[model samples]
Target chain A: DAGITQSPRHKVTETGTPVTLRCHQTENHRYMYWYRQDPGHGLRLIHYSYGVKDTDKGEVSDGYSVSRSKTEDFLLTLESATSSQTSVYFCAIRATNTDTQYFGPGTRLTVL
Target chain B: QKEVEQDPGPLSVPEGAIVSLNCTYSNSAFQYFMWYRQYSRKGPELLMYTYSSGNKEDGRFTAQVDKSSKYISLFIRDSQPSDSATYLCAMTDNAGGTSYGKLTFGQGTILTVHP
Candidate 1:
């Protein structure tokens, strides 16, 4: 397992509140991604960063945002949380491609 | 249609049984197909990947991809209790994997290998 850790392994927040999940990697990989896992849907990419300050929207980016200020840290923030946004989020990092992707444990966020 | 489709099967099998998991995609541009195993409440771990079309075997796991049919499969021989996890099918195209491997994932099939 790659040394990847997600902070606030679990969190509960009120609707319309702001929440941020953090992913820190020791591998210093070039690519980092944020994805939300729902019951009926697989992991849906919210945003990803190819390098510091270089990011792009994913299919499910409408309600989410991301930032990668430093190579080791990637953050996913819900500007204003909604009940529909309750889901488990995962972070993945790869050296270059998809040959091997190490995942952080996960962050379970619930918007009440 | 979604790029990838997999039956979210709660497929149950007895210990030592052979288990088959699969996913199908519509994109012919997909060149890399991968299978990930995810335990509950955890992130997905890569299991197998087959570039283009063919079969690759490792340990008790076999991965098969038929690009002509846009179908990919993972077969586990002699399933074990530790193998009880959600199997997700993911694919990356030259279109998606360029900058970083942007993969499209299936809903994931839950499997339980019992004793």
Candidate 2:
């Protein structure tokens, strides 16, 4: 509830297609993260940005990429979608003053 | 072993009952502990957070961290139907570098409070 929102609440795309999910925040927090939630795996971080133009790979960053040009927006892109990549993606923002991270509504993506 | 472990339970309870959820971790470096509540098809919301080892209370929720045992718990007193959701336990080392905002999470436990 930290003024975060993820676009394309639901999506279905064929395998090998390019897909992009957008996460926008209004809190102006300095840190933003992208995570994918899959059954049995809990939530795995994909990528995160600590500041504008600053990014880092997470535990499960093999098939994904992320970019942040502005403090309020972070984007996750799948260059070539795969069936195994289908999952619910969530965006989170951490305020500079607090260690707690707030999440955005998730995006459910399916790769056929 | 996984960094953090939790039972993924669809625990059903009656309203006004006391609920307990737990998580155990293998890492001793974790200094920050948190609990997040996630509803179906929605984002997770932060419910409780604690640093080091101690008990922190907020309204109907209480979070306990035991660094020596590498275990943590969240207790809900007088639970309500609105409290039904998946509870996730997350931790971080608070290393203050590249790992500053990174958190490792446990497989969430599902709770349902029936009216």
Candidate 3:
């Protein structure tokens, strides 16, 4: 509930197609994170950004990429979608003062 | 073994009952512990966070951490239907370096409070 929003709450794309998910935040937090949720795996971090033009790979960074050009927006892109990439993606923002991370509504993507 | 382990339960309980959820971790370096509540088709929301160990209470919720046992728990008193959701446990080491602020999470436990 930290003024975070993820676009295209739901999407379905065929395999080998490019897909992009957008996360926008109004809180102006310095840190933003992208995570994918799947059964038995809980939530796995995909990528994160600490500031403008600053980014880092997470535990499950394969087959995906991220960019942060502005403090309010972080983008996650899949160069080519795969069946294994079908899952719920969540965006989170961590305030500079606190260690807690607030999340966006999330996006559900499917690959055929 | 995974760094954090939790029972993925669809525990069902009646309203007003006390609910307990737990998570165990293999890493002793984790210093920051957190609990998040996630509803179906929605992202997770932070419920509680504690640093180091001991007990922290907030209204109907209480979070306990035992660093020695590498275990943590979240208790809900007088649970309500609105409290039905998947509870995820997460931890991190804030001691700096590249791992700072990076969280490792448990598989999560689903609880349903029926009215």
Interface RMSD of each: 2.7, 1.9, 2.3
Q: Give the TM-score of candidate 2.
A: 0.96
TM-score per model for chain B alone? 0.94, 0.95, 0.95
Per-candidate Cα RMSD to the true structure, in Å, reads: 1.5, 1.3, 1.5
Q: Which residue runs of candidate 3 sit more than 4 Å off their true CA positions?
A: B95-100
Instruction: Give the Cα error of residue A28 in candidate 2, in Å.
Output: 1.7
Residue clash pairs of candidate 3? none
State which docking tier applies to candidate 1. medium
Write model 1 residue lDDT over B1-115, tens digit each, in one string: 8889999989999999999898989988888788999987778988887788999999999999999998999999999999999999888775335566778899999999999
Q: Which residue pairs clash within candidate 1?
A: none
Question: Residue A63: error of model 2 in Å?
Answer: 1.3
Residue-level lDDT tens digits of model 2 in B28-101: 88998999999988898988889899999999999999999999999999999999999999998884444447
TM-score for all models, in order of appearance: 0.96, 0.96, 0.96
Q: What's the true lDDT of residue B55 in model 3?
A: 99
The collision pairs in model 2 are none
Candidate 3 lDDT over B29-90, as tens digits, reads 99989999999898899999999889999999999999999999999999999999999999
DockQ of predictions, in order shown: 0.61, 0.65, 0.61
Q: What is the DockQ of candidate 2?
A: 0.65
